[model samples]
Target: MSRALKATAIRLTSASALAVTVLTAVGAAPASASTLTDGISATARAENGNGACAHGGYVGGPNQSSSCYGGTTTAHAWCADFAGWVWARNGVTGLSTLDDRAASFMDYGKKYGTISNTPHVGDAVVYNYNGSDYADHVALVTAVSGGTVTITGGNQGARPGHVSTNATSSYSVGSLPWGQRISGYVSPAGSNTPSLPNPASLPAGTLVKSPNGPDVKVIINGAGIPVAASDVTPDKYDLSKIVLVDDTAFRALPSAPASGTVVHDQAGGANRYVVIDGTALLIGAEDWTAAGYNDRADMGVPTAWLQNAAQRQLTTGIVVMDQTGKDPKRYVMVDGAALYISGSEWTADEYNTQTLMGVPGEWLKAAAKKVPSTGTVLMDQSGTDPSRYVMLNGAAVHISAAEWTANGYDKRSLMGVPGGWLASTVSAQVSNGTIVKDASGANATVYVMAGGVAVPLSYADFTGFGYDKRPLEGAPGEWLVSAAAKAAPADGTMLLSPDSNTVWQVVGGKKKAMTADQFGEGKLSFNDVVGVPTAFTAKFPTV
Candidate 1:
């Protein structure tokens, strides 16, 4: 209803006060004797046509009056304000603890022990409550019939800033919009609470289902784990403990269940699997007891879900070995592959401090014997040789100690490989954009790798182009001496002389001076400019 029409109705009601008084004098119940629910309903209905609820823009507008905003001209999100006003007018206590935020109503209910899952007349329904401290909206539940609830709320229209009318909406029980759900229902302080289970207080391992779907999930470590319907049995799981929640609250939980949970196929299959680091690993029937998993419950899940989860490999940094002691080798997972961990390296990297998960011998056999992922730092721990190398381009490149510290390689986790892998000749060169200098020579020159050749960088260029801030890795002196040398920057490289304002774009082996307008027209940024020595820029002819 529009506020203009409501004003006319108010005027007509005022003119009929005498007639109403005469009728009440006979047998009608007076307004003062109305119940709390009736009072809340009447107050909310009377506010429908008051004015458009405004957040801030409607300072002096009809909605931003003293009645709701404490006489201040500034308007705020007033849905809570309107609700609080109606509650306080009806003499509901705890208005002092209430605020303008919708979440405060949930807090109020908890403090008063009046929060529940079932809705009742005069209850405040909170939407999008994530169990901690967030809720999107709140409204007064004016009616609760079979499978449906009717609510009236202020600031309820589509337009946020200038919503004009208090609105009423009806939703079938547990059927709120996506990403929004009734988190809880808060009744008035002294009302008799319903006997439904409160999801917030439910313990871990409790089963829960969303009203939107038929799937049931068990709560593990605050995450939802899907359980097949066939797996839900009377002896295994208590069906009566399943709490019904909305989709938003269900999805807000962690997607994957906790690690170390055992599971099997829904149809009572013989194959069993254990979840570790979000991946499911098959546990052989013979090895299950040896792996210390004989007592764990093997929960049944959908077959397709188990297969999809098995596709993910165990996460890196987990240490694992065979439980039967057949291989007697410990390996650390990296990029879905296992790299054998030498005894010395294991102690140095503190792998001994981590828990070692035991798997079947076949799983260990399949994961072993693969090269460590590229960029892994490796060292030969079998002998006294102190050489350290970096795996790049499928080969090891020798890196000196000075380079290791300068490039922050010392901070990376070092994996020990067999001495045979490090004895092979260096086949990979330093990649482009890497800064290198010969550490064996006195006052060695700093160079940047370009086109597989080392190009000397002047001190001014090194600092001006911001290359000094990058890690300077040391290459073998013999390798740098034999490598080709480049006199000019690579073609298509953008260069800027340290002393000049002109920006040069290298094209077709020539330097082309770019104007300010041309640089802007080409959508080029000065941040891409590489400061280089004037002598290097002079090698390219101006075109």
Candidate 2:
């Protein structure tokens, strides 16, 4: 019977940190890995023409090294050393030689398991080809094919100590002369040896169960993952069982991540799909870029369109790309599923106006009834006027008497700003800090609390990911960056910075844009910033 052996190899090394990747195989007993060492020693012994020395023990010579093929009257071939190790593992004390090891395998008693469809654990995986007339490199079988014989190994590299998903064809086998002759196989003993565990089990051919996770998520590759509820497995469908999007009741699902979508390519091709609120938006393979998507500019029509459609269908937040200098704007598939136009220069107003709130204030008022209203309204500018503002508890706040707030304002707070204003915005019952941008990507702020009291932040030292110490300087009306937020340190010192991008944090000698994740070792991207361009320079007077 034709068998499919999905074996993996792993090489080990002692010099540097090892790169570790895991592979899982089901069923199938593995072949003995030590056989490779045995084969190496036996080959050396045969080449040296050492007679009884071929018994496979530590037969050393003039300048010997410790290996299964011990005699190093010549330069040591690390490959031979590996072969010797296998022999040593086999309990052959003195007959240490590659030739001896191979010869020993030829002997009746010590040979390992035989190779076949029913391969068991600890069998030597061998292959025959080329003029070499014998098996060369070897690895222990960890998993078998069909409930039995199969192949796989890792850690096979030039150093032989490296681990990999499969045997190294060049170094493992090709390193020796005549390394490619199939001479059957052998299994090793003693491994009640604990093996690595496989990852979560997946029933074969199962896909798209139900909604459960991120509101809109997608998976392009499912190699290591099991079939989950939030996926669409068109690739695995049989002709009779195929279901089209129109035929399914996907729209009836809630807009939760659990109802997210998964797309697969079964036309022996790669395609893209977007997951938006449980449904998929397929861009197909064409017209994606023609419709202004430059990310897949060069992809074939079918592939590109499939990806574009996915992006369009996403209901997730947008990710604006910077496309100032490039001919065409590019798109990034955020959350690994939805593609958004990327590389485009953005601004506070641009970012704000892009949201649903950016619609006309009249439109907002018309839809105001749709959103839920909390009874206790905290007015931020309450001190201004009871008719205009109302202080809920501590922070002075502003609330609109009308069902909806004015243009460019949210129903209960500022229109574009959600989570409320940083300072005047109440936290539980108290107000302590101001709103600010946390990073280059998004604007988020936090309020400072001390001794259980909301301590108002000031303009001295604000701590965050990136830092720009440049003071706010420019024509006032020209729009210097706004003060993002103010925070009073535990020491009573006030911290401050413009609301746009920079937050004061020190790295190496200079204070520049820095993120907490990066261990203050590298330079920030802004170091390359030339002066603001003449066109936009007026708008960013304080930058």
Best by TM-score: 1
Local distance difference test values of all predictions, in order: 0.60, 0.28
| Candidate 2 accuracy as TM-score | 0.24
Clash pairs, candidate 1, are: 52-164, 66-71
RMSD of each: 18.7, 24.1
Displacement of residue 436 (Cα, Å) in model 2 is 2.9
lDDT of 2 by residue, 136-210 (tens): 234333443343332332213343122223322222221221233333344433322222112112222322221
Number of the top-ranking candidate, with lDDT as the measure: 1
Instruction: Evaluate model 1: give its lDDT.
Output: 0.60
lDDT per residue as tens, model 1, 89-201: 45566666566666677777767777765666777767655454545566677665676666766655443322222223434334343234556677667422223343434
TM-score of each: 0.39, 0.24
